[model samples]
Target: MEEQRVRPGGPPAWWGHGPPWRDGADGEERRARWPWRSTVLLTAFVLAGSQIAARGQLDERAALDPFARVLLLIAAGQLLWRHRCPRAVAFGTAATVAVYLGAGYPYGPVLLTVAVACFNAIVAGHRRAAWAALGMLWAAHVLVAHRLYRWLPPSGDTAASWGQEAVTAAWVVAIVALAELARARREQWARERAERAQGARRRADEERLRIARELHDVLAHSLSVINVQAGVGLALLDTDPEQARTALTTIKGASKEALGEVRQVLDSLRTPGDAPRAPAPGLDRLPELVEAAADAGLAVRVEGTAPRLPPATDLAAFRIVQEALTNAVRHSGSRHARVRLTREAGALRLRIDDDGPAAGADAGGGGNGLAGMRERAAALGGTIEAGARPDGGFSVIAVLPLAPPHREEEDR
Candidate 1:
């Protein structure tokens, strides 16, 4: 997998939790607080507006009294708890407005309280409750305006016009429509937030796997050479001082090279999105692998030349050969290994073999070298096979595609 290119900044403020309004887990924004200041201001507006409206409807409706003021206050007060108890507040405000109108009080800002309540309920996912409340209030207003007005409060009240009823019905429909629109927008925002979070997690997992493969390939190959050289140096320390010094020198060179490669890998983490300072290792470095194996007492022969290839394919091919030879030095009894590279029309085939009689019981089931080799091949849309050869030898075979399976989309 390719390394991720992070943007030049820290993670987003809402990276883990999503936006502030969308912080709630189960639809409602539990962490977002409802404002009591708006509700308090609304109450003052409704009280003052009713008195002004009462003067215009003095001949048609009952005058606004202390009792009428109390009813308006009750309706507005219900909005304070609309977010916490949407269903209850929705029905409560609707019922209060119905009773005030039935008492022949002048029509005014009392209906605004019901609108606010229903808005909160619908946005909170209480659609049925909000719709039912508005329906009940409309039905009560119809009965009071058409039939009950004959026996109700104003001394000489007449039946209200159907025109007035049409206006009220239009207001109810508008509130419900507006609330439905808000609910849909809220749900859309939430879905987008969830998709972003899921994408982030998947990218993080892929990066972790890429880093693991890089570390295993570098450390395993270098450490295996060091181990073999250390064993040789110990055996020749007293018998052949000259050979012992050469073994020690090989160990130093191998360790230094390993440190440089490991540091390159670490640099990618610290400065993400920047091109690597040193070019990645590729098939051109096959000579280095051959010399390193010789230092560890293994003779590796190259059979075919590698052609110019894409960076990813070349890197994967090199790692596969390096890992296969490392496995031979650590597990195979034979000191000779042969690597044959075959460049086909669309793919590159690599085969590494060592004539062997198993070195130990855990020959094939050893460390992560083989697994890392297979992972590298698979990442390039390739395949790897490593096991005991039918002719009493161990072989690692890989087939890698020359081009990536698909063109990567450029970052937006």
Candidate 2:
């Protein structure tokens, strides 16, 4: 009966966990704040303007009333909570203006304060409230103008009255336009920020997938070697003590190498703030890997000619050789394997052929090891082929391009 490897449970390392952007979306929004200092300064400025307007208009009308000053104070103070309660602030300020006009206090700078409140309402996304305030102020202006025209001799539809009404329209339109423009800019900035965050998260996911492939390759090969050597050791411990010792030693070496590579792969996930670590295992490590396979009692022959390869291609090549040797050692009943490598036409080609039972190969075919190898090669803009070699054994071949998959897009 052919050996059957026990598979690990759970989804692939690359899967699971909701989209990173979804977590970002669930984050709390920044709460609105009312700038106490700025509000105080604005209120002071409004008070000063009202005082000046009242001073000038008082001589032309009735003396200033004490209660009107208190109402003015209340309107100015409401600015402190403008962000927290924009509609309330706007309504409060507008009502203050109405009171001033009704109490016969000259409509001077208090009108400007109410307009500012309306602008704040619009800025807070309270468009309905702002529009209501605008209508109220306009109505107040019309009524006040009519009353003054009827009672005051010099104010009978005078140019001053018409001029004030015109200026009111201009100011109202200006406030609404400026507030709407500010809102648009705020929304645009938010969208840009969200897009940037999503892009960052996307890169993180791709990085995670890459690391998962590396881990799969490392563990799969190393465990396969260890498993085979352990079996050999256990079988021969009594019959051939020396050979058993050698098998145990081989298992140790293979496990140690696997652990080191695994550590290196994990270090890649370390934060940038960590001390720098070594570069990943590359093709230069292939000879050592082949030696490890030989130690595992497999006859591994190598014939390779290659120039300096890119980092990604080099890593893929090492992992491919490692995975092929691991499969050969674990499942191939035969003890002989061949590894051939060549750099041709701007690509690296690797081929591993083993005299292993096609049955063991068939049993391991659906494993993540093979899937990971294919994924790694494709990620580096390459391709892989693994199948039974017609006569009796299994073969794995990989062709890796020098350039990355996104090279053209990056260049552009």
Candidate 3:
């Protein structure tokens, strides 16, 4: 049996890990492998420093005690695995340093090791762990200095040494804080990139929906009319040859028009580097559109003074009337439809009514044509009212503002 391959964009297995690559596989690989190399280098440096410290002691007993040196080397080497287990490394290093300090070992590179451990703890996303490490290290430093090295004054005059201790503490804290900030910045950048990718996917989905809606509106009404005419032509072929020829000619014209409309939509989807074509059906094409519907056996009436409209508004108006006429042909089964376009004050108004069946029952309440018209109107900051008129017919009235709404302008 062949193994089932996981196709791109397919659903994952039931028990699979979350998203497999939310941060991407490449980033996961980097996070998994790079830390070990840094850990190894850190261990080598720590071990070499311990050896040098064991050789150069102010006290003879401290220099002779090799076990102290060995323990210090172990503590330093343990830091090599800090990225893997930051909290464990931090506690272990702090304990080792306390023991070395209590045994009269000099505080040469111990502070540096503590700083590295604190930084690791922060990067591991353990804030409490870092605070605990800092507290433990400071307590151990004060206790060891007071009991063994007398780094603090014997007279308990802290002002003399407090400044030095405070400066050193501040340096360590600053380094850890900087490391934490860097980690936070990296996480923020990753989140921003993920959000942008999500937005792109969402936009692609919306574009696909828009195309599907356009295809449905364009094909549904055009194909319905063509189908009806073809049937009529076939029935009249022998008895009325002239009528049959006219029906056949109408069918051919409708098919050609549908093809051109589809091609135009597809061309709009193409990249800008491609050759330019005729613009989409705007107000300029209104006369041609009216003629086409008239040829389809619908006496389409146009009224009102046309105004200079924006490109988007003009496109919306064209599509609205196109869909309205298409619906009229499909649902009303009527021979006459009226379209009215008027511009008043700061708004444009469009009204399409047909003497078909009442709007509620057959004027496509939930169909694609009605939905497309509503979407087109809404895109132009407009409101559309489509329902049955009291005079036993369907009416569609849309009112669009000359300029987009304030909210829409803010979004732009």
Q: Which candidate comes out best when scored by TM-score? A: 1
| Cα lDDT, all candidates | 0.85, 0.71, 0.68
Model 1 Cα lDDT, one tens digit per residue, 1-412: 1111111112564443333223254324442466578889999999999989999999888998899999999999988887677899999999999999999999999999999999878877789999999999999999988888889999788888999999999999999999888767666656665566677787787788888888888998999999999999999999999999999999999999999999999998999889998999999999999999999989999999988889999999999999888888888888899999998868999999988866877454375777888888888889998889887789888999988698474221
Number of backbone collisions per candidate? 0, 0, 0
For residue 186, model 1's alpha carbon misses the true position, in angstroms, by 2.0
- What is the overall TM-score of model 2 with all chains considered together? 0.78
Best by lDDT: 1
User: Which residue pairs come into collision in candidate 1?
Assistant: none
TM-score of every model versus the real structure: 0.87, 0.78, 0.79
Give per-residue CA lDDT, model 2, range 376-403, as digits (tens): 8888888999988777788999999876
| Better TM-score candidate (1, 3) | 1
Candidate 3 clashing pairs? none
Badly placed stretches (over 4 Å) of model 2 are 1-39, 58-63, 98-109, 146-161, 269-276, 343-345, 360-366, 387-395, 405-412
Better of 2 and 3 by TM-score: 3
